[model samples]
Target: MPGRLLWTLAAVMLAAGLVAVGLGLRGPAGPPQPPAWAATARPVAHHAPVMARSVPVRVDVPSLGVRAPLVRLGLEPDGSVQVPAADRPGEAGWYDGGPTPGERGPAVLLGHVDSAKGAAVFYELGRLRPGHRIEVGRADGRVAVFTVESVERVPKDRFPTRRMYGPIGHAGLRLVTCGGSFDKDRRSYQDNIIVYASQTAVR
Candidate 1:
């Protein structure tokens, strides 16, 4: 119910924006489409070997009240990270581009705020406030707790890469998800709201 509460508010904002956009685009006649080009299959290039490290076993955030299992997955063909299922779904894996959680770098955890079917694990993540706690349990029998320092919503197009992936003085964590108004045509949220937390206590 806590997760749904936040999602409902987001949905309302999306609905209102859609109505306004629909009213504004009343008279629109677009140009005709160009001829389609022949589709050609390109050879897939070999990539460097993935660092087959074990995935974090679980995540616990007492402040926002979350404790759930986590799973690791590779990137999809479209370059977007896969979203874990909402009901009894595993945690969405980290983007290989970033550091692993608990390592001496910035680790990222992404999830769907809410899928088409229902509330996702991170539906209430946007509600987290500064000074909250986020604990990540690793398969190595170690747990990392990060203290929330800040939370901000940034446009997807203008996501602060340096801030998210840049070097931090110490181990850090970032929680990301699609937020802001949902565009029906795009079928995706317009912006990404990220919560930045850093290691405060580890056990």
Candidate 2:
């Protein structure tokens, strides 16, 4: 709860690992200005209760038609987050070191914008807007439904490490992927697509 402790955790999360960068991705102009999601049905409120710890089994974003099995991601020997392996069945990975999807803290999810052959899990990640729905099915059989609050594209050099991971007052979810122009020289995208959402409901 202390500010210093919060930032310490955030630093660990950032150093844990970044998402799997795609080989070739089509970058959008940039992240759109975030409008409030308050006008939408079931706007984010503090009424929702945080659930107990449980690993997520799958993730579904109906608006984007994204439904994929979830995989566990953790720190590597080098102290970085492990990249989702190509042979893995899941399209995206959950940062197991952090809180679960429905827990009273930020749940981090990572994915690639594209794969070597073609488009991957988060190919249309930039298209998501405020109020879009994100559902994470937990192993405990309960589903945590989150409503998108904002989406942004920032240069990888300036990724919001603390802002994205420090808060823990409520249940939150962060979906991250590569975006912006691909710097062929660097072999990665110039920016990162980050989706910030909060638990609005549960079942």
Instruction: Please tell me which predicted candidate would have the highest lDDT against the true structure.
Output: 2
Model 2 TM-score, all chains together: 0.85
Stretches off by above 4 angstroms in model 2 are: 1-20, 25-43, 87-90
Off by over 4 Å in 1: 1-54, 85-90
lDDT agreement with native, every candidate:
0.56, 0.76
TM-scores for all candidates? 0.68, 0.85
**Compared with the true structure, what per-residue lDDT tens digits does model 2 show for residues 1-203?**
57897676656655532433555544444323223342232436757889999999899999989899888988777656665665542489898878999999889988777765467787778888888899999999999999987787767777687767776689999988777777776677777778889998999
- Residue pairs in collision within model 2: 16-80, 16-81, 17-81
- What C-alpha lDDT does candidate 2 achieve relative to the native structure? 0.76
Sequence-dependent TM-score of model 1: 0.68
Q: Which ten residues in a row have the lowest lDDT in candidate 2?
A: 30-39
